[model samples]
Structures are given as C-alpha cells and as structure tokens.
Target: MDCLAGSARAVPRWRNVAGASRTGKPVIVPGLIVANVAVFVLTVVTAGSLNRNFASPWFAEGALVPALVANGEYWRIVTSGFLHVGPLHLAFNMFALWIIGREVETVLGRARFVAVYGVSLLGGAAAVMLLSNPLGPTAGASGAVFGLMGALFVLLRRLKLPAGQVIGVIALNVVISFTIPQISWQGHLGGLVFGAAVTAALVYPGAVAQNRRRVQIVAISGLALLGLLLIGAGAAFL
Candidate 1:
C-alpha cells in the first residue's frame, strides 16, 4: 500500500489514474444491449403462431429462471439480460445505459467499467441465487444497470461532480421501483450495493495517510457490512 508522501493530512491530492491496465480499453459494454436485442429478435421469430410460446427451446425458457442457472444453465442468467419480453423493456434499459455508461467509462477508463459492470452482474446473480425459487424465471439488465448507478454515484463523488444532479437521478429510479411489477427489485438492489462497494475500493485505495486511510477503510468496510446484511435480509425473505 503506497502511503501518501510526508503529510498525513488531506486526500492525497486526488490523483485519478486511468485505472489498471488489466481492463485494456474501456470495452463498450454493448454486450448487455446487443445480447438483449438478439434474444428478443429470436424470441419474436420463434414465437411462431404459439403467441408467446418462445420457451419451447430449453435455452429460451431458461433465461428468467434461476434453478436452471445453478443446474448448469448458468449462461442464461448473464444472457437473459440481453433478451426482453418486449420492446419497451429493452428500450428503457438500453436508454439508461446510453445516458450513464459513457461518463463512468470515461472516469474509470474502459478497464474499470468492465470490472464494475461484470462484478455487478455477479452480484445480481447472487441475489437470484438466494431468493429465486427453483427454476424461477428471471430476466432484465436492471440489476447490472443498477450496479452502474452505484458505480456512477461513487465516481461522481470521487471526482466532486455536482451532487444535486446525480442524486436526483438515483432517487427517480428508486421511485420507479414502486410503480413497476416484475421489476426484480432484488437484483437491482443487490447490484447497486455491490457496484458502489467495488467502486469505493478502487477509488480509495488505502495507501494514504491516517484520516484518508481511515475514511477509505470505513467506506470499504461499510460496503462489506451492507453486503452481509443484504445477504441476510435476502435469505430471510427466501
């Protein structure tokens, strides 16, 4: 851990390096949008007179269901986000990404964006794992997208961006949760918490002075604690 030189005061000059080299360039997380579009198209094509019978294929039906995921159909949970039940569902999520992802990718660089998004997806999976019933179908990028919200919030704070704007957007999304059913609030909340934590760890590496070190430590620890609580709460609900 590289401590800030000399003075044990202040936040070590806010040196925002362009994240680690591992991420390569900010990979356009088009995977989420692209995957969803393709799946939706396939679902429409295969509906074939069966109206909504897009699930004849084990692969398509497995998208929203979690038990299939634990039982080796694991790829579907990740892939399911790409497929939507309808155009409206896909449009809303992709549009949200268009608005927020670019800024975050710019801040953390391409590599960090990928890390944050990937982890958030995993985090969302954890929620479905704990709460979803046997083969309970699940889909949507809202969880991973919420993870973006969490990550974006942290980065905005780290860079000292305008708070009113950022926080308002978050609150609005939260409001949307109440009005929407089949929204998978579980996944969204889980991903949001995880994304926020990961971003905090990356942004505030504890290699600094006492005050900052303590702050970073506390922030990271809080994230961990929240994750534990979320797990417990989710388990209780299950």
Candidate 2:
C-alpha cells in the first residue's frame, strides 16, 4: 500500500527512469523553504531582534501559547510553525528541512508532503497546548521538521534504504530536545509520533487499491480533529 508500490513493481526499464525523475525535481520543498524564509524575514524586519521578539505582535499572535489558543487564537497552531525565535533556530530548522524535505517531497509528491507537514505542525501545537507551559509561548519549525524526519524514516525503511542515519539523527535530536532550555520536547515528540502515524496511513498497503487521495484526506482530517480535541482539553484542564 505504499505510495511507490505500483512504481516499485514497474518493469526494470521504467524503474530506472522513474527513480531518476523522482530525484530530479521537487516542487513543494523549494516553495516551503522559501515561504519559511520569507516569513522569518518579515518577522525580523518587524520585530527588530531575531533572538527576542515575544514583545512583537506577530510573535504574540502567532506563537503557540495555550492561553491564547484557548481564548480563540486557533490559527497559532499553523502560524507558529512558520515563526522562529532566532536566526540560529530558523537556520537549523530550515537546513534540516532542506536536506530532508526535498527527499520526502520527491517520494511523497507535493500533496502528500503538504499533508504530512500540516499534520506534524498541528500535532506539535497540540502537544504544546497539552504539555507545555500554558503561559509561555513556543514558536519554530522544528516540530514540522521533526515530522519530516519521522516520515523520511518510514519511507527510507520501506524502500530498503539504509535508515541508520535517520535513526541516529532522531536520537540526537531527541537528546537535544530534552537538554536544551526553552526547547519544546513535547512538541518534538508529538510531531514525530504524529508524522509517523500519518505517513504510515498514507503509505498503507491496503490503501493502494482504495482511493489513495481520499485516504490521505481522511487521515489528515482525523489528525486535525484530534489536534483540536487536544487543544480543547488543554484549555479546559490547564
């Protein structure tokens, strides 16, 4: 039920051609990179300081603060994925995205790649709402970047590619997530798990015969609903 299952079974001649073309160009990845960078530039231009912008209205409005989200700022879940606290943060996340995102986008294609990223972003926001400080704000693309890592991990393994490097990167990032101050380990963990789940659903063998597009839509919708529920619960409990 993998996205590439049909392609994998193609005749040898076609397989080589497909492989070459698949790796040749990725449309969504570049657009995503550009969008993230553009948003960061806007944030920096408006906020004046890369490292400290909590005082900036964009940060205040876009960052995932449980209290604000609970009070009806639901858009933060998506917007926060585009905002970064500093250049270092943006650079690290965008770099990871550039390296990993292009590969994943190539494999998943544009639409599915977008779905995985959106789910990962919402999943991270849900984790922040549920487990992070209700009053503190969290912002970055790390969550969605981590999500891409999870999806890539599954994808590489499925293709019989060496996934040791992916596993190693995830392990290293997990360690950093816990040790780094102000980092949202919850968001990272949430995005990783959610991304894996979503990707698995997307590539499920049973879905190969079914309407794959419909399946992807359902899976993404379910994830989005779950994220909303988590946000509601967080608001209620925390």
Cα RMSD, each candidate = 7.2, 4.1
Indicate the worst ten consecutive residues by lDDT in candidate 2.
Answer: 14-23
Per residue, candidate 2 scores C-alpha lDDT tens digits across 1-238 of 2333343444264422112223347777788879888888888777887776545787778888888888888888888888887788888998999888877776776667888898888888888889998998888988898999999888766666677888999999999999989999989998998888888777663465436667667877898788778878988886
Error of 1 at 36 (Å): 2.8
Give TM-scores for every candidate, taking all chains together and pairing residue i with residue i: 0.72, 0.87
Show where candidate 1 strays beyond 4 Å: 1-27, 49-61, 133-135, 208-238
> What is the per-residue lDDT of model 1 for residues 1-238, given as tens digits with 9 covering 90 to 100?
0121111122344434323323332347665567666767677667652236345363365475655554556566567666565667778888887667755665665656776777676677667667667446667778778888888777666665555666788788877765787677767877887888778877777665435545554654565555545544544454
Question: Model 1 compared with the native: what TM-score?
Answer: 0.72
Candidate that would win on lDDT: 2
lDDT of 1: 0.63
- Among the numbered candidates, top TM-score falls to 2
Q: How many pairs of residues collide in model 1?
A: 7
